[model samples]
Target chain A: MSDSVVLSLAEADSLAREVLEAWGLAPDHAAAVAATMVAGERDGCTSHGLYRLLVATASVEKGVVNPAAVPEVSEPAPALVRVDGKGGFAQLPFSKGLPLLVEKAKAKGIAAMALNNSVHFAALWPEVEALAAEGLVALAFTPNHAWVAPAGGTKPVFGTNPLAFAWPRPGREPFVFDFATTVIARGDIELHRRAGKPVPEDWGYDAQGNPTTDAKSVLDGAMRTFGGHKGSALAAMIELIAGPLIGDMTSAQSIAVDAGRGGSPLGGELIIAIDPAGFLGDRVDEYLAHGETMFAAIEGQGARLPGTRRLAARRESLAKGLAIPAAFHAEILDLLQKGKDHVPNPPQGSRAGSNGAGDGSGGH
Target chain B: MSDSVVLSLAEADSLAREVLEAWGLAPDHAAAVAATMVAGERDGCTSHGLYRLLVATASVEKGVVNPAAVPEVSEPAPALVRVDGKGGFAQLPFSKGLPLLVEKAKAKGIAAMALNNSVHFAALWPEVEALAAEGLVALAFTPNHAWVAPAGGTKPVFGTNPLAFAWPRPGREPFVFDFATTVIARGDIELHRRAGKPVPEDWGYDAQGNPTTDAKSVLDGAMRTFGGHKGSALAAMIELIAGPLIGDMTSAQSIAVDAGRGGSPLGGELIIAIDPAGFLGDRVDEYLAHGETMFAAIEGQGARLPGTRRLAARRESLAKGLAIPAAFHAEILDLLQKGKDHVPNPPQGSRAGSNGAGDGSGGH
Candidate 1:
């Protein structure tokens, strides 16, 4: 974390969008990506924010992402649709596809849209959270680069595949529960590596299934499931439901194929949006009554609703303007400088084997 | 687990429904409850089957459930409806509510239904699996009775709330994933108590936050979360999304509330069903293509998907008939014999407590 001059939210987003455009993403696509990344930053999720820009840009330059590719929507029913990413940037699928599903859900009680052949998008909460803000409930699952192991084993058989869900509540923050079903997310591991720190031993295991605190050991080996077999079961179940059920790539097939980056083949995603009013009607009037009574009973006890922490965080962010490291601000400036220097040249050959662009800076 | 008799599926359903009727449930409601419970037996979920008859019957007889209650459906959209269970049996909500949701989903592509004020309805997988067999994908979640602790600290704070999702797979078994978000379910603890055995130390914590191998400790205290804080967070998240978000009660306010027994309130459930053909269309053709390739790769490495084991158990039950222990069989007969006894003219307040319940001889 650099301690330098702070960047306003607008300045940070401007730089990110410029860098994305330099990577050959269209204006609209670049803006969408920039918005999500900035939202993550503003919400204190620095790991998923601007820090991821360089690698995403590199993927685009390598022809792995089609700047102008259109998402092909295959609508099978009024409530169901499939968006073939068409080798396009992932931002398009999440931004364009999610709203479509939300629209259908608003009209028809519920809607589910699946995206196949897509790249890794940003965190899922923002998309679902936005829907919740619109008074709709949304749940989305994304299976990405593999890292999680199965229960009772140290095999890297699943991804940190995060599951996210959001529900709009009257007179309160929308309840959004977003988490990776792994002991730790890949970004957390990278953060440890960057800081030259060892992880807790139980967070991961080495080749012989021995727990290790060494960051290098976890990087070289496999990450444990969040709750042993339960988490692994969830990851596998998510893959079966989100991928196979939705006609996306399976984890095994995703691993077998090379996805240009030498990273785990990016798989697919499933998003379900629900219009609460469509189902609850006047019953929506009862939520505040029910929730208040329940929360009142446990007030000041060791119980808080799921979104309370996030809500508290958001409150603090709005009051104090999202506490960010000065070092990260400097890194953002450096990326802006690099984008200005590199122009729009397409990346040559496979830079995939390397752990992203070796700038030691983060932003996507 | 009645070993003295091997009732065919039809016979078992008939007898079970007959027993429910004797407890004052309407004929249709009794049949629905019996059908769900018998299906659990058929699917080898012995823990949730006929062994639970006494608890269900007690709830009805104690006036905790309304025998003549009818679920009310309120539709807010073409694809969504809310089913108010009216403090009735869980089967009432499913029997009358699910078909409506399914019908709308078939026409509109998706349906979201929230079932509120219903008692425990046994394991959720059977419900979703049945829907999957009808060529739909279903996701079901219900906040349950608190019996397990959150990840870190000791003391029970969350239920062994199960999340179950089933997807329709062409030319293969409908992949189903159902699991309780606890280290060990309460049923397993009762099993240990009945067998005069102990649980693994790691499975639970005493009231002082120390690990214990004694099953009684967990029953008197709390079972630890499976993977520390992350598991607790997951359970907490589930309670918020599956409970409060659906206009139901959270665990904090639901402690000591037994949905199966009388005088205790039930929690809420949210079920989302989707018509895959509406979403996948021609891509449904690729479901197996992609999933098989992935499963084949994992198979090459000896990895199996979650729920594959349950499928195997189901097949065996079909082939060999449902298995039941001789002792358990006798216990059921004994209960039936008690129902037949001429002690029907007991005092108004006459009811058996833990001590009068046959020493819990059939717990396991």
Candidate 2:
């Protein structure tokens, strides 16, 4: 009745690990990276789910990713931790540094982790949610390829930079939300292109600095930021905080480094963690309850919190398994077969430009 | 030609100090608050400038505020500074905590200051600009009265919820922005109401949950957030971080305590400072230069950065002095002549509701 082919969580996990491993990823790196794919699938984020397997095949071509490189972690100061991803995917470095970050946050009341020179490979929610699971508040940011323009300008200057925040709640699911500052994700433009539909006017501008609904021109031109100047300011903040502050690439620099390889974006990531207990001491629960009241007030009026839908989908996906498109499953399988040899050539006719296709396919 | 009266910066400062001192504020409190008022005037933020002195007089009426309470500062953790405002305005506590926060950030790489039970009196830009002036990156947030609604609902569950961020520049003025998450400000609606003008469609919703242009109806209903759902999420984050995270009141709780007394909102403020050297170390200059490249890209496109207009106004104001409205100046002079007794009544019909005229008048 449908194009969907459901995959159990175990099957999904194994499928991701196997494809990544066949491309010469080390067991440690493959497992950490595979978790992102399975988590995405389980959470109903089709953009970042097993669909990224095909995107990975295109990115993992020879000499691009250091599939075997090990991430290094160090605490350069009392409340700051540094992670050198060594040109590998960010997952391993994040996994390696998380415990130390949590520990330092508990010790100092506030802590930050600078993950530098890493290839971004997943959504930020998982990372921040992990901190919330440890009963800490968390914020994370990273610069992507230069796919968006600054406010009031037509040129592509800022990244579709993403910002994520998580807050811990007692005896319930932690509230989490991760979204791009861009009006729409680049993947959506590709979707419109494939479907032969025009995008919304607010989404992007044409090469002549005019608003355009034609998906192709928007892809060729520049995407606009959400909320206009306010969003532009946030994008700039993300670029500075996650880029230079962590000693990594800005969006423009990132694309220049990318240069038509269809690889994952290379840059830095910043994670800040705060321990409420440090400020509230024994009164933590009292204030957390106050947060619940605000939550109730929002829901009482039929308003949903940012991650409400994701959580609902998560529960459904957990119970009934993931429903991925059958065609995508075949593409992933085809990628699994051909990618075993790890061909260096870019995917045939799939990528549009240096910053094209899966450039935004993996992260939501 | 214009109905404006020029006031030298020194004269403006003295006028503010004398008015507040006459209202029974301690000399220290008066001086600290006077600086914010003058800075706003210098930077062309007329909302938070000397006009706030009028708002303050209304809020400071009766025994609601502690005219002479010294803030107490404590370091409960290595990276946390706590300031008990003791029913006083936030300015004094922020000033009291700034040095300790700077020391902690330098020593530990990151530090946070929590000011609890304080009354907000100015825009957040000055606090963050001060930190950037000290060579540290800073972020600040505080909840105003609950005058704004969440993304999809009509009831006002969230405050205007202003967020401010500042990054230190090597030699140039720091990149600073302080703004509410609302689409427009509550004060703008009042301005529209007085002029009998229809507000923009995106500004607010009426009591029936339909977008309305009637400023009075919108004010009676609720204002909308800046970027729809994304901005709503930010407002929620601000409420948690600045509210519950600091063991203070939520906007709803704050208003409940205020009881429509026409006073400044009562709550907590959270300020986080990050030492760039902690992350970049000796390579700090190299990375800061990387940030400059991004700034050049933005400016080269002829797109101005946030706070750009304010900085330009600051220079002109310094050279030419501030031009206050002649009528407003006369009113202040009259209040100054008769306010020596520190009357306790809330200022006439100039005040509106619990979250009335000046609720958003002092912060941009």
lDDT of 2 by residue, A45-76 (tens): 87887877766655667344667667778888
DockQ of each: 0.35, 0.53
Q: What is the lDDT of residue A224 in candidate 1?
A: 74
Residues B186-302 of candidate 2 have per-residue lDDT tens digits of 888999999999999889889888889999989878899998899999999999999888877788887766677657887788999999889877877877887888888889989
TM-score, candidate 1, is 0.84
Candidate 2 stretches with Cα past 4 Å from truth are A1-4, A343-364, B1-3, B343-364
Shift of residue B70 alpha carbon in model 1, Å: 4.2
**After best superposition, candidate 1 residue A200: deviation in angstroms?**
5.2
Deviation from native of the Cα of residue B264 in model 1, angstroms: 7.0
- Tens-digit lDDT track for model 1 on B252-313? 44444443333433656778787765655555556645555545544555666667776787
Candidate 2 docking band: medium
